[model samples]
Target: MPAARTRRARAARKRQRRMAGVEHDLSADEWAGLQEAWGGCAYCGASGAALQKDCVLPISRGGRYTVLNVVPACASCNASKCNDEVTGWLRRKRLDERAFLTRLAEVHAGL
Candidate 1:
């Protein structure tokens, strides 16, 4: 368990380093607005759970924590989506790829 925890911590640090020097313009108000707009996990539509700030493109893949790149996601979806491209991960999970894309575009437009 300790080793697992250490490994996870190391991976998180690496991700942080990868994110260094990248844009991080998502604000608190923007996060609130995003949650309100989505009303749940943006991918799975699961409401009433604490949402996480998930990058549409993972940080490891050069995605920043910017407004257009971030979305509200449930813990499960966030964990499952670790380091994967959004569309392919959604497809693999049997999620509505087109719908997510459309909604994402709408949300970004509204922002």
Candidate 2:
């Protein structure tokens, strides 16, 4: 039980540090817009699956939960992508890396 408690405390502290000084947090409206704009999982194009907020740059690597960095992903893709850089992960998954990048850039430009 003491070990479990220590793990939990460490996890909480890590979350706090990750969130510290996080400006430009995504708002409800921005999230809705993202969903509409992507129309599916941003990585897998899995429409109608429950979406999770995924950071293109992992929070552990200094990414913030901001509009520009966040994308909607299916649970499968989100879990698979944990803490990995987006382009490399996409390549490993055999996904269309260039298409994703171009679409992301177009979306960012419109914002």
Candidate 3:
């Protein structure tokens, strides 16, 4: 069973590497920017929860996983956004960048 689990894990890692190439990991600056961008849940504005690194621009659309192109988002938001551009995802949720950023800031500041 343990060997099977290890094999599955290795297979998953290989698949991810093949799919993402060298863009699977985020850079240091990009990570910091994500923390700043998505201080909490984009939906209910919750904070201190686990965050997922999300692409402001989808990699499929030629987006780099760089600082300016990444944002920290709650798991729910990340799942909801899927592979769409961040702007479009926000719009679909009836949110504007300004509002979203403001809320993110507020969540960060805990104000």
User: Which candidate number has the best TM-score?
Assistant: 1
Q: Global CA lDDT of candidate 3, please?
A: 0.68
The local distance difference test score of each candidate is 0.93, 0.92, 0.68
Clashes of 1: 0
Candidate 1: list runs displaced more than 4 Å: 1-6
Candidate 3 ranges with C-alpha deviation above 4 Å: 1-26, 36-38, 41-44, 101-111
By TM-score, how accurate is candidate 1? Answer: 0.91
- TM-score ranking, best first: 1, 2, 3
* lDDT (10s digit) by residue, model 3, range 60-81: 5666666555667788888888
Candidate 2's displacement at residue 29, Å, is: 0.3
lDDT per residue (tens digit) for residues 1-108 in model 2: 999999999998987877785665799999999988999999989998899999999888889888999999999999999999999999999999999999999888
- Tell me each candidate's TM-score: 0.91, 0.86, 0.59
lDDT, candidate 1, at 15: 72
Off by over 4 Å in 2: 1-9
